[model samples]
Target: MSEAVARHWRSGHVDVEFLPVGAGSYHWRASTPKRPPLFVTVDDLDRKPFLGADADTVYARLRSALETARALRQSGMEFVVAPIEGRDGNVLSRIGRRYALAVYPYLGEPRAFGNALTAEERVALKAMLVRLHAAPKAVASLPRSVPAEVPFRRELELALDSVNTAWEDDQYSRAARPLLAANAAAIRGWLERFDELVRISSADNVDVVITHGEPHSGNIVRSGTHFALVDWDTVGLAPRERDLWLVGGGEPQLCELYRLRWRLDDLSSSVRVLLSPHDPDGDPERALRVLRISIEREPFTRD
Candidate 1:
């Protein structure tokens, strides 16, 4: 990884140290004598976000999103923590068959995943989101437009329907099968309510804009006195409510739609993980935990 980073970024020499910071990506802190430290991120282009996309397609979307962040920062929206371009004039470097890598200027520490946003922090994020929503034209490169609905609802449905059918021979999958069977009706109810909210979202007269899909406190950085957003991987065109829902001032029904999108998306992914052949290890165990939360979450309605 160190060799790859030094070669791609045209760096003198770097000593790399692994940092378990973000999910879905491997992170490292790269130190060079002459220059300040850099944050290096490597992702498996064949997994998760790459599910339907070929490696090339997923790579293109991620690179374009990061480039858009760079352009936004250049356009004076300094809150954008964009990826640094490699010497090849690309934001990402294809490390090997399975993995893709990118470099970024190491901003300081990000907040913990469970930490809630304070009132002032919420205000700051809301103001930043307003600027982001207003400036889709700042960057010539735009990512794919996503639907108003959550991405993984179908997967959730499939998991729920597989109640009678047994999961493959795996401990977690075995446990998940009965859980799904017991909660099938409640999951369906949540889905129905979600669809109802989607109708309201579809009828609303709202402008679509560039959104940082997961701009929760975990993705925000306190830069000096103000906050800046990191992780531009989820950047895309969507209704303003998608982001405004996170910070306040969004319409009630629209906000509820997005809120469901968030929980159901996580629930669905967790269900998919459990229904599939997941081993009894770190991620699979975590999926079981998330599955519990998804069904029991207040807004989701176990009834």
Candidate 2:
């Protein structure tokens, strides 16, 4: 076990044995003698730097997660794996200014979405989202300051420029260069359509709600026969469509439950996928193949 994990476990006052597991961030399955096993995730501040330069942001995110979890539990949803407070009563324990450790009671292996979800599972997921959107005000108020709203035209322009620069400057590996070059035109066309869709959605005043940000299959876990949502780091107030898009968009069942009238164009989602930065650590060949399929398979239309 690393020093940070040791320090955090000691501070939490839990006699647990840490077993290292997983890729991406450092994760451990913490087994204790008297208490239930816990899942501990440690983010290296120097590497991720998601909190920016402010320690306050970290505190706010932790508090927001705890508040959201409590609200969900009180609402009779016991699946959210809320953060466990350390001995110092803080969800986030700063370890030597290099790592932040947050702990939660363990949930078993995450349900893989490699295959299509069952109809019953989809219904359950939709119900969970509805309850989450209706969480109490105290939970909604805990997120960090809302980001300034920027026009989609400006945002797309900036992203287009950045993507072009990355390709032209050879910022990515040689294997990725050919793929990016081949799809440049398709990528740009998609962005233009996306910008227009955003304009329409904004003018229509789409409903906003506290969202899980990314509720895709990987983030949803199975606890016994029930399901739970994990990774509250990106939890915040945003367009209800953000989460809906990830879950099935405009499906009659979801629309009836959420009472959503406006349907986001498919291109709107494609733009998001295209704008996402390439993973620095991912396999270049596989990443390129995925990118090509994502752009070419979608019909590029303009208004």
Candidate 3:
């Protein structure tokens, strides 16, 4: 935990202690006087092997993530726990070199909202999505540090690039490549049909909110009947569907409810098969696709 804090910022500050709160990457619990204690989970950019194709890419991603979250905070999106200057509010902090930390007000351990979430809990999640996808303020420009959403694409792109370089050869080609290829082909078809999807998404009247970029249940905290989202690292401009994609995938009934309530034509099956958490074989194919498409897609959208 201390190591995690050291990754983004200098560990010199007192009163800021990091406790282990979860698994896979840099998850933690932090505390300070200004804000209540809170739990946080972040992708570790400091892992020895590194998260990107090269050290340079990893640095780019980490720096950009910090800058982007800071930018989002400027736009009034507070659902995310960010790492920025000052210990102000419930946001995370960025100190030292790459260490980014935040205090969440300590709402207890993280838990799934579960299958039987009350209407209010569901509404909270949806409302959180609304806040996330709300239009960026006029001056909320994107960071030039790391790849943007279009450049980042989906997560699959990482796998593709790694395999191409043989860095991800052992696990990728043997397990994940084929599934990703099929999904990639499907998404290409979907892109050709993107206009239709966009029309449906628009007509659905659902808020095209900017999102946490990655809003798996793991990033959510539930207390009684209420739920709150954390982790601002992946925040970006996107459809509300981005938030629901994983939620619906986890609960088929919720996906159905989403379809009926929002009138979505079809959610991406590729997103499902590729991003599934329970994918035992590992989602190599989708990873490759994400890296590929990220590079192929334009850098950012023009208003």
Best by TM-score: 1
The residue-by-residue lDDT of candidate 2 on 56-130, one tens digit each, is 555456556556665656557675667776666666776665666787778865444334456665676777888
Residue-by-residue lDDT tens digits, candidate 3, 139-258: 234533121112223443454334334333354344445544545654455344443444455454443445565455556666446566665555544454555654443233323332
Comparing 1 and 3 on TM-score, the stronger one:
1
Report the Cα lDDT for residue 126, model 1. 90
The worst-scoring run of ten residues by lDDT in candidate 3 lies at 261-270
TM-score of each: 0.89, 0.69, 0.47
Please give the TM-score that candidate 1 achieves against the real structure: 0.89
Q: List the candidates ranked by TM-score, beginning with the highest.
A: 1, 2, 3
Q: Model 3 segments beyond 4 Å from truth? A: 1-23, 30-42, 46-52, 84-105, 112-118, 143-209, 222-226, 244-303
Off by over 4 Å in 1: 50-52, 136-141, 279-282, 299-303
Task: Please give the lDDT score at residue 136 for candidate 2.
Answer: 74
Cand. 2 TM to true fold: 0.69
lDDT of 2 at 74: 58
Worst 10 residues of 2 by lDDT: 258-267
Local distance difference test, candidate 3: 0.45
lDDT of 1 by residue, 34-144 (tens): 787888999877664523457777777777778878878878899998888888888888776678899988876545675677787788889899898888574634666
